[model samples]
Target chain A: MIRLEQVSVFFGPTIALDGLDTTIEPGITGLFGPNGSGKSTLLRVVAGLLAPNAGRVTFEGSPVATSDEGFVRRVGYAGHSAGLYSRLTVRENLELFAVLHGRVRPDLEPLLEQIGLAEHSATRAGVLSAGLKQRAAVARALVHSPDVLLLDEPYANLDDEAAALVSCAIQEWWTPQRIALVATHGAKKLKAFAHGGLILKRGRTVVQGSYRERPEAETFS
Target chain B: MSGVGFVAKTAALTRKDLRVEARSRDTLPPMLAFAFTVALVLAFTLPDATRASAKVVAGFLWITVLFAGLIGFARTFEVEREEGALDALLLVPLDRSGIFFSKAAANLVFLALVEVFLVPVFGLFFSLDLSSWLMLALVVVLVDIGFVAVGTLFASLASQTRSRELILPILALPVLVPAFIAGVELSADLFAGAGLDDIAARGWFGILLFFDAVFLVVGALGFEFAID
Candidate 1:
């Protein structure tokens, strides 16, 4: 479980994320907010990409800053950027990342197939369609077999087929032992996969509860 | 052992970068050819190819490597930035300097490889002897290390901006001038039969070594800021 205690992220005078506090546990959690509402910033904080000005972000009982590498190893992060090489083929891209993360498992080929990228494995990432590229981006994240998945606007640019593939992967990939936090404005379609949701308005958590209780509250303020 | 892990990670990253460059095809060959062609042109222009001339200045050769090295360094992080691999690399638990050292090592290797072809061609053009050139090679290594040490980090930062490759050399060259001058002067003095024991040559050598050390430390210290 990841805990954010009174966390605040500031960029000069503009407060990106105000004094925020939350406990993100195992299971799928959605961060819904309008543009510039700090959903990405909060997710970046959780992924250990950004440092909060005050307060602490901890995984389990240890401080996040103290065990960056140890904590980073546990997270599969897909930022708003596709975070992929357009020049290299899908297989080359995935292989490079797997090596970078030090995951030498022989099952990478199978995992690529599992992600439905088996056919496009040899296709250069730049040449692939938008949906295929996004799917490949997610695959790179999971290559390390991270226990925690932090995705920012993952569904962006993906078509229905690609979206379904990603959604299915997220569902199949999630477990009580693992956690997934996805930031998106479109949470309605994800209700089938996500168990709960968290809403942020102007850098503050406006709501945190199950989707069934308050489906209307999922929208940004 | 942790430092060793850092070194291994650095080597792996360097290899990965070289592999990427290799697949791209045009990156290294053009640099090798460019270096040799520059040497050939300099050779033909000299009064006599076998005898030292005004064009045979050691400063000029070091200057050549600096410019050529910048070409390779600029391209070093270009593809990675475009592809977003840098973010993925950052996400790894490796110390940030692991990224710097690995890149420096790889740049050193690529630059060294180009120089392997370049130095011989340079010697051929200038009518310089290989026996004396061996000492000059150490200066080349020092100059190249210092050049890429900071160049790689700047490349990473500048590759993201609107200027693209145009900005890296602009930022790198001014800082590189001192090291280049020191290296070139030191090598010229050594090649001119001034004993390595000469105080001026030794001072210049010390300056080049010191510059290399500074870049190495500064590169490691400032890499996180640059990458971030």
Candidate 2:
């Protein structure tokens, strides 16, 4: 379980996450918000990439800081920008992550196949198309089989087929032991997979419940 | 996921860097070309008498290496920044110091390769005997460590700025003055037939080592904050 208590984040004068409080259990939790709605900030904080100004974030009860190597090992984050080495081949990129995570014999072939990149595994990531690169990023994120996964706008630049691939991969990877937080703009797509979700407006949580109880269109507009 | 041991993580990171450089051929060739071009320009421009002096030649060679190395340093984190790879690396559970050491090692290798071409060309142009080549090689190795130690830290810091190309040299060169001076002085002593036993030569070597140690420790300690 992950908990954010009285969490507040600021960027200059802008409030990125405003006194936000929430708890997420083990499951797929879709983060629904429009632009600048703090979805990315929330994921970043949970991933230990950013620290909150006024509160604390805990993973299974321990505070998560960027410097906590032990805490970070169990968590995986893929941001809006696909964090990949452009000069490295898809296989090499995944292999590096696996090594870092201390996997002695990483099952790379399966991951490559799962992400629909087995054919392009040898290709340099710099030359891969946007959709394929996104898939590669997803594959890299899951290479270590982290207990906590945070993905921000994973399907932003993907084509329909690529998006489907990523969506299915996430579904296939999700389990009771792993907590996945997917921040996305696609409501209908997320509705199909997410058990529950939170809706944010202007850095505040406006709604929190099962996807079926999402606020009407007037509340969002 | 338990993280790998420190040595294993550092080796993996270094290998990744070398493999990327080996395939892309992006960093080393440009560094060598820049160094060689500067040497050629210096060869034609220097006065005939001044060009023959070992001190003058050593000074020019060190300058060429320093400026050429700036190119490598600038690109150190630029590659990571280009594709958001730095964030990926940071997300790993290994100590951030491992990232710093691995990058410094890789930069040292690139700089050393450039020196392989540089030393021979420098000797040929200056009409100097290669008798002191061993000592000179040691000087190059020590100096490269100092350079990369400080350079990698500043490179990571500069990568966060919008004007990274401008910010790297500005931030690195000022902090590197002591190392640069030590490198030039030590190289000059080596070229002038001073043995390692010579008091002045030993002093400069000590300075080089000291600078390397200090910058490496600082870089390792401060790297997490700089990137975070």
Candidate 3:
């Protein structure tokens, strides 16, 4: 389990995350919010990309900081930007990430096929289509088999087929021992697949429960 | 990530950068173009290349390299900034300082390649004596360490700001004065056909060695926080 306690992040006068407190259990949790709602900030804090200004985020039982090697190893993230080296081919990018994760040159052919990038493996990430780049990023995140997955808007540009491929990949990757926090505005498939949801407004949690109890994006505001 | 040792990580990152550069041909080509243009203009404009003062030749040669290095330094970090790829690297569990060192190492290699073309152009164009050109090469190698050390750090820091192209030179120049002075002073004597013993007597060698060491230490320690 990952627990956030009084976590606050301030960007000068703007409050990005306002003293958020929550506990995320072992399963996929949908993180929902409208524009400027701080969904990304909360995920960044949990993923140890940005340290909270005022509070502590603990994974399992230990505090998480950007410097914490264990927390970093445990988390895999696909940000809003498709974070692949533009000059590297999709295969090379995945291989590089594998090496960075301390694995030997991996046979990522299976993963490439899973993400529907097998045909585009030799293509440089810079010139890949938007949907393919997003898929490549998702594959890069999963290459290390991280115990905690923090995916931000994974379905933003993907078409129906690509979205289903990614959804299947994520669902298959999640096990009882792992926890995944997926931050998106609203997707029916993601809503159905997620075990629970946390909706935020201006960085503070506005609601937390099963989908039926949670308000839709339009009604929540 | 824990078991990935520092040496392996650094080597991997450096190799990846070089491989990408080799295929993309992005950073080096433009850098080479810029450096050679400086050499071309100097070669033609001077009344007589060989008759030019050692100070003028030396100053221009090093100045050409210094300005061209700015291009290479910025380009080296451009790979990391694309599509927020830098955040992905940071998310890895390795010590963040390794990122700084790898980047500096790669920038040093890029600058060295530029000089490979640049030094020869200066020597041929100016008709300088090559008997002691090796001594001049030593000065360049020594001073470039300090140049790249601070250049890589400041490049990363300035990358965060809005006006990075304008900000890089401004942030990096003040700290680089000592290396610039050392490179020019040592190279002038070498260009004038002075041997190592004679060049060493001038004491710019000491300044350069000390400056390189200090900048290297500062870069390694401050790099992680600089990006933060």
Over B118-146, each residue of candidate 1 has an lDDT whose tens digit, in order, gives 77676666755456566677778877878
Least well predicted 10-residue stretch by lDDT in candidate 1 chain B:
B1-10
Score every model by TM-score. 0.85, 0.94, 0.94
Clashes of each: 1, 0, 0
lDDT of 2 by residue, B1-228 (tens): 454688999999999889888988889999999999998888888777334677788789888999899898888876677788877888887899999999999999999999999988887777766687887788888888989998999998988888877899999888888887887787777777776688353688788889888988999999988888
- Candidate 3: docking tier: medium
Off by over 4 Å in 1: A10-15, A53-55, A65-67, A212-221, B1-5, B25-56, B156-178, B189-214
**CA shift of B71, model 1, Å:** 3.0
lDDT of 1 by residue, A50-107 (tens): 7799988888887764127787777788887778877778887787667656655335
Stretch of 10 with least lDDT, candidate 3 chain A: A212-221
Q: Write the per-residue lDDT of candidate 2 for residues A113-133, one digit (tens) a residue.
A: 877999999999999998888
Residue pairs that clash (backbone atoms under 3 angstroms), model 2: none
The regions of model 2 sitting more than 4 angstroms off are A211-221, B1-3, B49-51, B199-202
In model 3, the clashing pairs are: none
* lDDT for each residue of candidate 3 in A1-221, tens digit (9 for 90 to 100): 99999999999999999999899988888888888889999888888889899999999989876667667777899998888999899999998888888887688988998889999999999999999999999999999999999999898888889999999999989998899898876457687678778888999999887555454532432
